[model samples]
Target: MKKIFSFNNIKTLLAVLLLCMGSAACKKLIEIPNPVDRLTPKDVFKDSAGAVLAIEGVYLNFGYYELSQGAIFNGVMTMQTGLLSDELLTSSADNTFVDFANNTLRSDNNAVASVWSSAYTNLYVVNACIEGINNSTGISEKNKQQFIGELKVVRAFYYFNLINVFGPVPLIKGTDFRVNATIPRTPVNEVYQQIVADLTEARQLLQPAYPTTGRERPNLHTATALLAKVYLYQQNWSGAETMAKEVLGAGIYNLETDLNNVFVAGSKEAIWQLSTIKSQLYQTVEANDVIPMFPFMIPKYYLSTHLLDAFESKDQRKTKWTAVSTMDIDGVLTDFYYPFKYKNNTAAATPREDYMVFRLGEQYLILAEALARQGKLGEAQPYLTEVRVRSGLDEITPATQPAFLNAIMKERRTELFCEWSNRWFDLKRNGTVNEVIGAIKPEWQSTDALYPIPLGERRLNTFLEQNPGYTE
Candidate 1:
């Protein structure tokens, strides 16, 4: 693991203290100052309010430029992985994107580096928060549990992304820079076991109700939803089914009938969302990143033909979630389609959208897949039908187990695209990366399932090792 404080110049210990303190008062967390005033972790977590602010500060880290909003981890990885799969196509000549689209990624790819660095950097904040909350003198036991619960989920979430992207990764649980700097990669299964342990504890510690009105903070259901996903990735069918059913049975969320309403701020479907900071120009990073100015105005990415063809003619998602543009190609008129999931491109007086992290619709799919994988097709049909019915499509009834599994996979691909590298990870976890993605991307190798560890990180940490098929 890389030393947390030294990883980014903007994230000094003093700056981190101020950033945590500033989260409660500032309207925008990222715009906080970098003052030189020094304070230990104890100083910041001395009060209940400061502890709350420190936890909120971790949410700000999630929305940072390199992580989710700025198209490095969530935004860029979503598009690039879609391109790597069959859901997206490169719309520009940018080599950074084309490499992902083409499955020719190298160890030096900046996006891969950003994903690695940002994840670990944010994980450091979460670990520190966990330590502070546990050792606080003035904070109540109830408050400590709530804050620590949220921090554990955040920590597990980063590890979830790390292990999925890079295979085995160092599982750093403490905030000790000296210990973490020299840690070696843990086995992928061991890392997942830690994730499961963290989330299970988090589920117990969290309240049923969301901490804040915005659903920006993780609650019991949020932890449950993430745990369901972790179980699904591990192919723990019964566990995944039970967890998904738990979230569904809670009755706190509903599937959005209107697909267009799902991504907007305060949607009932959103289980956990990232609250956006108001800006003079862009409403949210996703809106500015995805919505194109015109049909052929060189958007960062566009929907792939394969993805466009996956939808049925009457599927409302195709019309509601995507847009078409016209361009003149030589003598004939050509049209291109782009993801229109986020429609607000410019900033408004208030935020038009918040980034959706977890939602109710995905739970249904998880339940469907879990049941289908366990050979319980009869029990799975209704859950799969629920998602399809909401999307204005006919209910599917796959007779055979293999057919039902395929249906669930297809539903996941269409429903969850462009959200948190879902398609990429799905193809990987299903062991079809070489079969499905390789057919589309000729250069794709079995070893390409996991991305190369960032070269700089490998050099800095002697214990770190590169993934297969990459050179240091």
Candidate 2:
């Protein structure tokens, strides 16, 4: 078992806040680390620079863990969920990925625990930052509000993934560990209510333009785009259409004509991206893990045949977004396919991709699906066709609402494949988990739609209940 750390201590909060700073004080802070030693939150938030570092620390913690190490930003959701959803296949039998591919996850599974623990760890940091920002007198009211808004939106992002994967999770909106440790899981709808509230207020607090260089930080449009996705998941079609249209019409982003350039840093297609100074040499985790380094080198994870078969004929995505390589397995030459969306694996002076979080391409699909769900087939046709035309596929003009909805789902599966577990979440949202996964795996069960709540968490908080179909 991995060593479990408690966030109940004020010292724990200070250590995480300081150690994650990634600045000159990081080494100094770590040297004095002691669980029994306590530091007041005011000591850290006493100045504006400290306040800024507190927030940056949250992002640094995200960057500290890469895809191979289970970073929440792109790793666990994009890869583990991909394996569970049939979008990816594990190449070796010795790895933990086989459990995900086989859909036999347990509460004790380390990867499952990693996703749960990592999210809560970040959440604690974000919540502490929000509280510190509010209490700090050194920061201007304007900056404090903006900082709180940013933290809230980040908190929403964490909860969004937790609620989606775990079904229901304890909503820890504050940094009080005593209260947090015993809180029962909040209902999915209530958790979403908090997410909507966070994003809605964040949109009002954030400026139209990004706060920092590039599109790394969440901006006004970023909140709107995420809210649109939230509404779509809730089946609020009109709300989804309104929010999605706001992003699509903002004139800030454009659909990249060239598929190869979409994932590049600062691309107009990106709504929100995350960058790591530490990864300046590695470029991106997607490239490092998916691309083979040498001839006959097999990738650890590759695209599944199920995902490859979903693409239409002559589709530009199938050709441009995927790549093929050869390897020798048991002395027999074998061909393998993998995602090549971000194609830089070797060390370089400058990085190419920033790990896309939200992009304009998804907004187009959201708008198309929302409009179609509302029976506005003709109005939705152009939005749907916009994505298709860029992919070198013929413009789709589905005559019926059902046909348009079906078309949108297919496009979503192909366009958003291996992205943020879109395919896994889509199957659950569309109520097709049983129908789709059952046909593929004979051992599939309806309850397998939701992963088991980590057993460590259950041991920590007795109020927590496990998702069905897992042994206690």
Candidate number with greatest TM-score: 2
- What lDDT tens digits, residue by residue, belong to model 2 across residues 132-173? 778878888778767887787788888898898989998888
Give the poorly placed runs of model 1, Cα more than 4 Å off.
Answer: 1-15, 18-38, 64-74, 277-280, 349-351
Which residue runs of candidate 2 sit more than 4 Å off their true CA positions?
1-5, 8-13, 18-38, 64-68, 328-333, 349-351
Write one digit per residue (lDDT tens) for candidate 1, span 58-168: 765665322252223346567767777888886678787888888888988887887787777777777777777787798998888889888888888888888988898
**Cα lDDT, all candidates:** 0.78, 0.81
TM-score of every model?
0.93, 0.93
